[model samples]
Target: MKISAVVVTFNRKKLLLECLNALRNQTYPLDAIFIIDGPSTDGTPEALLECGYIKELPPKKGNWSWETKNVIYSPINNKPIKVYYVRLYKDVGGSGGFYEGVKRAYEEGYNWIWLMDDDAEPREDALEKLIRYMNLPGVIALAPTVIRPTGEISKPHRGILCFKKIFPMIQIPLDESKYKSNQPVQIDFVSFVGPLIKRDAIKIVGFPKKEFFIHHDDVEYSIRLRTVGKIYLIPDSVIIHKENIKKTSLIKKRFLGKTIYRIPYNKLWKTYYGTRNLTYLGRIYSKSKFKFYFKLLKRWAVSVGAIILFDDHKIKRIQFITSAYLDGLRGKFDNEKPKRILYGGKKE
Candidate 1:
């Protein structure tokens, strides 16, 4: 199968290099490598240029005939493997990057697209394992086991796992032995990092919603894909996540008249996206099941309380939380983009 690996990166040049090296060493041959860079001042572009493995391509054409031109441009001197970099001046966030990457993959006529973060370094045989398991019937997307820097393997939500009214921690076994075997397990959701998506799935469900910016965009996409086909977690495939884990409260709070919350400095935006998006998912599912609506409300409430009491931006956090809930109630699909912060900017 022709597989195109799409990686979206920000300012982590070192980690991005590690990830690219791992990709280059993959057991399965890569058809193409596309990197979507959010204009980095960190010399990442120069580093990528130095790598030599990547072939720089220009921005995609905006016309309808762009697909035909892309196909013609896909071949690099008749070589099957091609590499390209796209630099975006506006920071559309990770979701935007993903959407662009997937669209490019499809335009290039790749049968499968492997999505990864700049920090995700897969095991040597990760792609091979996923490709082998993807041959199973009805499997549309396959994810590898995610490992932390501490050598602990992160687990995905599998089998009938349900959240209570409040988004309480759902504990499961972290033992690697449970997942060491070469078995394909069914899952309700899987992270976008290091997953192989069949082109057919993308055609059926479409790319993730770019408006989500970064958070539950994956969840929303996966759930919709599930309707057309199943998503699987292949235990034998593994990838290491090289980023630091930042904890942010999953709730929003309303205080005074304005929304107050810390703009995710490093990786805290994931928390905001997760909380807000999950609330939206709960409401979406609640249309048929009343319990899901109540469960979503309960979780949103708990999240708000957590932010108000624990998060540093208590008042702003409350405002964000309230806004999210009210928006969800009103079926708001687009999340308002947070104001950009300038260096030495004015405080709210």
Candidate 2:
């Protein structure tokens, strides 16, 4: 299979470099590597040039609209692998980046596009392992077992429901002896960090909706993809997530500690999007199952309570939660920008 790897990066030049290095060492030869950058001011362009693995895109001067451009590169090896870099002028977040990347993969006629994150470093043979299972029937997307920084594999529980309603779970059994294995399991969702998506899947189900911004975008996309084809969590492939859980300081904990609780940084926005989008998704699938409506109510209640009671930026969180609920109710979803810095507020 001719695979194209698409990586979206923001301000994390260091993490991006680590990700690139890992990609460079992949066992399976990638047809191309596309990097979609979000107009980073952190000298990422220069670093990309220095690494010689990326090509920079032209910069836009004015207007806030997100720009899409691609940079093509070839590996330094004797055979030389082709690579592409795509940079956007505006910060379109994860959903927009992946959408553009998948579109590029489809346009370029690649068989599969490996969607990845800047913070995710795949094992050398990760791509190979994923491709080995891509030939499996009915498989549209293949996700690797993501290992958290704490040395624990972040495997999703089988049969977990979205919107609080029961859904078929894709469970890839965990083998304690080996860090990685390959088995067919049912899953409701999979992270976008390191997933190999077939070109036909994107053409059929379409890319992730850009309205979701960061969180729940993967789940939303997976849910839609599952409608047309199956998504598999390949146990043999592994990606080490370089995410550090921030510890709340004791001093800050004393004042607003009760309001702010510890959650995986990656999941903070997910908590909002999962609740918000699940509500919207429930409406779409409501007629299919009455359970969906009840699940929506449960998610809405949790989201509202979280915003009003636990969220640090209670006002903004409430605004977002309320806006999400209202939008879901009105069935109006298109380019909804979230309020900035949702967890900090002015002191009285």
Candidate 1 residue-wise lDDT at 199: 94
Q: Across residues 160-201, which tens digit of lDDT does each residue of candidate 1 receive?
A: 234443243222323456576667877766667787899998
Q: For model 2, what is the alpha-carbon lDDT of residue 187? A: 57
Give the clash count for model 1.
Answer: 10
**What do the candidate models score in CA lDDT, each in turn?**
0.68, 0.67
lDDT at residue 66 of model 2 (Cα atoms): 37
Q: List the residue pairs that clash in candidate 1.
A: 55-83, 251-303, 252-321, 253-317, 253-318, 253-319, 254-318, 260-316, 260-317, 261-316
Candidate 2 overall lDDT versus native: 0.67
